[model samples]
Target: MLEGDERTGAGPKGALFCPSELRIARGERPSMIGTLDLLGRPAILIDQNGFVAAVNDNASKLFDDDLSVKGRRLFAADAQSRLRLDRLITQVRFLSGKPGRSTLQTVVTRSQRRPIVIDAIVQDWESAGDPLLPDMGALLILTDLNEIPRVSQSSVMEIFGLTPAQARLASLLVEGKSLEEIAFYMNISSGTARNHLKAVFLRTGTRRQAELVSLLSRLL
Candidate 1:
């Protein structure tokens, strides 16, 4: 997490604007390397000056042949991958926070495993208006595509405050099932299934089935 520590080399001025639980105020969003810990994503944040700012728990154990952090800088083992990652970082540093305009993504090919994604996104520092962190700093999210993503029922239930039936439907939808199939599988009437799905959509803040699936797919 982004604690105000000297070892990160981001300097005192570039520490995480949204601090971790170890050090936080009442309203910090805890984004990316800190707040997004709930998504179970592997991510690290870098300051505008190119120093490591913070790392999430999932990202800490990812230091191996594929990727590693050195002297407060992230490094890829392959020369080509490293070059691409550097370019992504440079591009993401200048991104505008206009919803879809905030992130740059690329796939990092690995030798022993399937390709992984490198998603560099602009941090939402401007919202907090903390002078210590720069607005251009980026958070790098690492995802291994080969891993079989399972739907976590508990996570789904908690995220949307769903009932057991609604959570089951949401999980099935994320797993690529149609509402008809889910209804038959769950031994519920088609109308009841649709009602449950509509309620799920309302609670998850999504309007369409596609939107709901897209939102839950991140958990995968």
Candidate 2:
């Protein structure tokens, strides 16, 4: 139920405001800000420069603060948060005016002392024709201490046309072992190992081991 709009302002690039869907937001009309607060997921609105404009109730509770975060540089809250946000921002920026989505995992400090892990999704916002808030930028949704979903071996095999053995080989490849190590562990010959790996690459349309690893790892 979260919503926001980008406005031409003296603030960050993708700054968002509550839309009409959330009634609890402090505005003359109903706004989505209230719904954002109710979501267990940590939601944040950022400006173009990647500064924190608004954070939902969950975020406030998690950080144990009700103080306004508006206009604060995203990274300013914590060094680690800053670094993570910077990377997300960089990815968003790289899309060059196209809306994009990306995910990041980072460690953050709770109550300015306790460390916690956060998984976040960064998405670009498209302006729906309003001139006042025209340059809408991005929305960041975060989950605390959760594992990112990964594709199972079966699913990966089905999607990439890998044989059962090749799929198992791909899984091992994602674990960072060398081909020889993988062969030894899987009780297969080196030649068979190379053959399985080659088939994995062809089925996955990858040309390099690192690329294959990255692609397969993200499936999960």
Candidate 3:
């Protein structure tokens, strides 16, 4: 959810393609696009016009035969949902400098198993403010809310040579838990949790919580 407006549902939507001239005209740079392509999650780059700029390999595989984003627009396969998605894009675009979020839901049918419902998160991309890089447009991230089960606590302990307490703290942090929440969950004091986190950071060579999360994401 965002400040002004936030909505959630099944899948994605938007314009078909970027005009040849508009491809590199505004938004993220080539390097940024390349970095997005490397992510394990499904990611799509869209211009301010809501045109699909680039799609990652995971997104291609996630949607499979049902959808294609290469040069086509990113949208729901169904018409009604497609219109909703268009409105979502408009809302997000209107927010501009401030990031807003909307989610759409869609079920991916399998050969024999039950359909898997996935949420596509559409949000404005915050710029890095690098003098050399131009601001890119918002990014669409596709997540399967059902996809659970992550790297185990023991796994993190083994990877980082952390103690049981440090491993527990690390696992919670990776799950986006704050230090206060971690302390409550572990029945420990905030100072204890902070000390454990400091140890975790030293062992993992990360200076911040975000960096630790990113490092763990790559490792996992």
Identify the candidate with maximal TM-score.
Answer: 1
Ranking by TM-score: 1, 3, 2
Model 2 residue runs over 4 Å out of place are 1-25, 28-33, 64-71, 76-81, 109-120, 127-134, 146-220
lDDT (CA) per prediction: 0.70, 0.57, 0.59
Candidate with better TM-score, 2 vs 3:
3
Cα lDDT, model 3, residue 40: 56
For candidate 1, the per-residue lDDT at 188 reads 100
17-56 in candidate 3: lDDT tens per residue?
A: 2233224333433455457557556666666666665555
Evaluated at residue 163, the lDDT of candidate 2 is: 84
Residue-level lDDT of model 2, residues 1-220, one tens digit each, is 2234523322222332233222224442113334655534566655555555456666544432212233354442555666765676665455423555556656655453445454544444443333332333445555454333334789887998888899888887776779999999999999999999988888899989999988886664
Q: Pick by lDDT: which candidate is best?
A: 1
TM-score of 3: 0.44
| TM values, all candidates | 0.55, 0.40, 0.44
